[model samples]
Target: MKIFYFTGTGNSLYVAKRIGAEVYSIPQMIKEGRYEFEDEAIGFVFPCYGFGMAKMISNYIKKSKFKSNYFFAIMTYGGKSASGLHNMEEIAAKSGIHFNYTNEIMMVDNFLPAFEMESEIKNKSSDEIEKKIVQIEKDISARKNQLIRKGVASDVLSKYVHKIADNVSKNFAYKQIKVNDSCNGCRVCEQVCPANNISVTKTPEFSHHCEACLSCIHHCPQNAMHLKSEKSKARFINPNIQLKEIINANCQVK
Candidate 1:
């Protein structure tokens, strides 16, 4: 079994770790040009973006090849999962793979535009997360199948909303990210960016290809990275994940 995961602030990584599979970082896979894997069971683990798969994960699904008897996806969301599971089902179908199991886990929402990190963390306790993970682990171990059922209204809404929102987000979401005066040109942001979208000189330079994962923002030691006028908002990184782990997952090839 191999679990492919994409994470921003480590929420998805935490869930992926709990799944107890040989985990592979999707960002590192893309960076190293690794797109083919053969395993008995294959899994995609990632956080939902705008009620759908993250753009990088979707792109990986399109470009990668896999040989597996069972394929599953686990999505983490901070609120209502909306139609992300359904969306993953469609992506799998398009990839000529049948999605065997799909599920969602509630976690802290780090989408800074809409969710306040401090408040979202208060919504779920450690016991709650462990309970959810236990259920997911049992189901995955049993190879249980879950059919995506969002009804007609939800299916239609998710399709259009995800398409439009993903497009808009990709175009403008990372545009406002800038290194403030507190930056000492540490180059941490450039090194941690999963997309290879940041370069450090006097400060950080951002490219237009950013995935908006915010790894740089949260991992910056100086707290120098911020969106437009966002210096006041608190930052979040999953407590179960360490800074070195994130750096290795996002920055190292192996």
Candidate 2:
């Protein structure tokens, strides 16, 4: 089994690790310019973005070729999964790909423009989340044939919302990432950026091709990265994930 994952704040990476298998980072895969795969079971795990998925994830699905007996996707969300799974199915169908199982897991909402990181971490129930993941593991082990279905109206609405999200990403707060006086040119942001969007010298430089995943901001050791639109000063990275792991999984500099 091979699992491909995309993460910003480690929520999806944590789930990918817990699933247990040869996991691949979608960002790293893109960096290597490799996408073809053959496996008994293949899985995609990533956090939901704007009721859809990261543009990189979407493009990867639309462009890649895969041969597998079973394919699955796990979408980890900080708030609502909404039509994320449905959206994935729609995108996959266009590529003549199908998923055997699909599910969602709620975790800390790291979107700083909306929720406070402290409250999000405090309110999340680890036990409840684990219970859900345990069930998903059992089901996937059995190669269960299940897909999330939604109302036609909502599904249609989601497509529009997804487009809006794409636009939001382009013009979002990170469109012009700011570095504070605290920055010591540690370059942690450059190392953690999945998009290869940051370059470091005395400070960080964003290459406009940003995914707005916020990995750079969340993983920055000095917490010097910030956006004017952000609602709180707090940041988050999944407790189960370490900085080095994130660097290994996402660094495109090398």
Candidate 3:
């Protein structure tokens, strides 16, 4: 079994690791120009953005080929997953692929503008999350045939929710991130950026290819990187993951 994942702040990577598969970073694969894949069983683990899969994930699914006897997906979300899994299905189907199993696990929502990181961290209990992940692992091992499909009501609501958070998906990189004087030129932002969109010289500079995954803002030790509309000053990285793991997962510099 093999799993491909995209992560910011480590949530999806944690889940992918817990599933006991040969895990590969989606960003790293893209950076290395590795696209075509085949396996006895394959899966994708990623965070939901704008009530759908991240644009990077969606684009990869649309263009690449994943040949497998069984396919699965696990979505990690802080708030509502809504129809994110279904949205992913549509993208894969367009490429003549389908998943054998799909599931979602709720984790801290890292959308800094709407969800306060402190509150999101405090409110979610990881114990319950662990239980869900264990069950998902068992299901995948058994090759479960469930596919997550909500009806029209969910599709309608998902579109509305997605529209509200669409800017998070936009490519206005230079205009999005804000860095302050507290920065010490550490370059953690450049290392953590999945899009290869940051370069540091005394302060980090945004390239036009921002994925807006917030890895830079959340992982900055100096707490200097930020969004202009962030809710609170608090930052978040998944408790089960370490800083080096994320850098290894998304770092474009190799």
Candidate 4:
């Protein structure tokens, strides 16, 4: 089994690692132009962004070629996953890929605009997380074949949710992230950006093509990055992951 993952603050990476697969970073895979992989089982583990998979993940799924008999996906989100799993199914359908299993796990809500990080962190218990991960690990080891269904109401909601979010995301999501004066020129943001959308000289600069994964904002040591909300929100990094792991996962081209 091989799992390809993209993470902002390492939630997805942690999940991928726990699944006992040969893990591969999505950004690294794209940068190296090595999209073709052969495995008996192929899986994607990523965070849900605005009720859907990250823009980069969708693009990667569309462009990549895979030879696998079994395919699956795991989506991690802080709040409602909404249409994220549904969106992944659609993208896979486009490429003639049918998922044998799909599911989601709720984690610390890090979308600063919607959730207060301090409160969410306190509420996200370690015991709860372990229970979920252990079950997922067992399921994957057994090659479980369950699929996630969003019920009638959720299915109806998902149809328009992603379409609306797509427009908003393309126009607004990435544009809002900005570095303040507190940025110490450490360049940690630059190194951890999975999209490689940030470049740091005196301070960090953003490219137009950011995926808005929020890795830079959450991982900035100085808490220097903020969105247009113009309010100071607490930053969050998965405590189980190291900053070195994030930097290495994203920055290393090969």
Candidate 5:
């Protein structure tokens, strides 16, 4: 089995590792244009962005060709998944692939401006989420009922939300990432960025294709990267996810 994913705070990575399948990051796969799967089962694991799938995942699915008997997806959301699964299914259909399973798991909301949770609540919620994921895995193993129907109204609303988010993501000017005086440039942020958006100059520099995935902001070893907002102080990364785990989790072989 092969699981392809794009993770920011590592909720998607956690699920991918637990499945014990070969994993690939969608951004890396898209950039390299390499698609060779020996596994019969193929899966996508990603966070629900803007009530739908991430643009990276959608673009990869649209362009890449794969031969596999089983196709599945496991989407992790901070709150509600909404029409994320539906959007992915639509993409799969366009790609001429049939999805055998689609599942959603609620994880800690790391999107600071939109949603914030108390530390205690976040910890408790993550524990509950892991339990739900275990159940989802069992269901997939048994080949049980997997598809969740989305009503026409829900689909329309989700599409509208996704459109707004896409515009915002593309048009919005991002705040510069600053490293404080207490800095030793370990270059961890540059290494972990899935977009290849960060580089170690005198300090770290952000490239134009910032997915706002915050992998750099969250994984900085020296606590160096910061956004120019008051929320920067309050913003927290999920403690359960480590950068080493994210990297070491089997994605793909070079």
Candidate 6:
């Protein structure tokens, strides 16, 4: 099975790894125009952004072609994973791909401002999150035959919300360059950038097509990238993922 993933803070990557399937980053696949899958089953693993799927995933699915008998999607959300699966299923249907399984796993609440400030105190430990992932995997494997149908109310709400989310994601403004004094000009961000937006000369440069996936921001070795906001301090980084892990985990072929 081939698992295509887009991970922010490693939740989606962790889930994809646990599935023990071949994994590829959606950005890399799009860049290379490669969708050859040796396995019969195809899976998409990504984080739930803005109550739906990430724009990058939607764009990739729309542009790329895949040949697979069975399609599956696994979405990981910090808190409630509302309508994300429904939105993915809708996108698959548009592409004439039928999804055989869909699963949602709830991890730590990492959305900075959505929840209370103290909510970070309740963040699940790495071990706890791993346990939940194990259970989700077991459940998916055991119930592979069942299909969860979306209710009419859910379908309508999901479609409306997804449209709104796409608009918001497209218009969202992000800081152009986030630098700190600790930056050593390692250019690691430039190398890992899927969009190739960042180039290292005197400093990291940003161009258009910045998907705001935070791959550059989060993978900075100097811990220098910062969004221009008071809430930037609240931005949580997963200590479990180091620089090498970020590179290896971000792109995998099981």
> So what's the TM-score on candidate 2?
0.96
lDDT of 6 at 9: 63
Assess the local accuracy of residue 121 in candidate 2 as a C-alpha lDDT between 0 and 100: 89
Ranking by lDDT: 3, 2, 4, 1, 5, 6
The top-ranked prediction according to TM-score is 2
The digit string of per-residue lDDT tens for model 1 on 1-254 reads: 99999887888899999999899998889888899899999998988777787787888888989999999888998877888888887887887878898888888877676777778877778788889899989998999998657788888888888888677665443577766799999877776677777777788876677776778888889988777845246888999998777877777322
Candidate 1 TM-score versus the reference: 0.93
What Cα-based lDDT does every candidate model obtain? 0.81, 0.86, 0.87, 0.83, 0.71, 0.67
Supply the global lDDT for candidate 1.
0.81
Off by over 4 Å in 1: 229-232, 252-254
Clashing pairs in 2: none
Please write out the lDDT profile of model 2 over residues 1-254, one tens digit for every residue. Answer: 99999988788898988888899999888888888998999999988888888898989888898889899999998876778888888888897779999999989988887788889989999999999889989999989999887678778888888888887685453465678899999888888888787888898877767777888888778889888778778888898998898998889997
Off by over 4 Å in 4: 170-174, 230-232, 252-254
**How many residue pairs collide in each prediction?**
0, 0, 0, 0, 1, 2
lDDT digits (tens) for residues 90-143 of candidate 5: 887998878888888877766655554465244656567778878877876776
Q: How far off is model 1, as Cα RMSD? A: 2.0
- Name model 6 segments beyond 4 Å from true: 109-122, 125-128, 147-161, 168-177, 230-240, 248-254
Residue 154, candidate 6: alpha-carbon lDDT: 71
lDDT of 5 at 195: 61
Total clashing pairs in model 6: 2
| Native-to-model Cα distance after best TM-score fit, residue 127 in candidate 2, in Å | 0.8
Model 2 Cα displacement at 102 (Å)? 0.5
RMSD, candidate 4, Å: 1.9
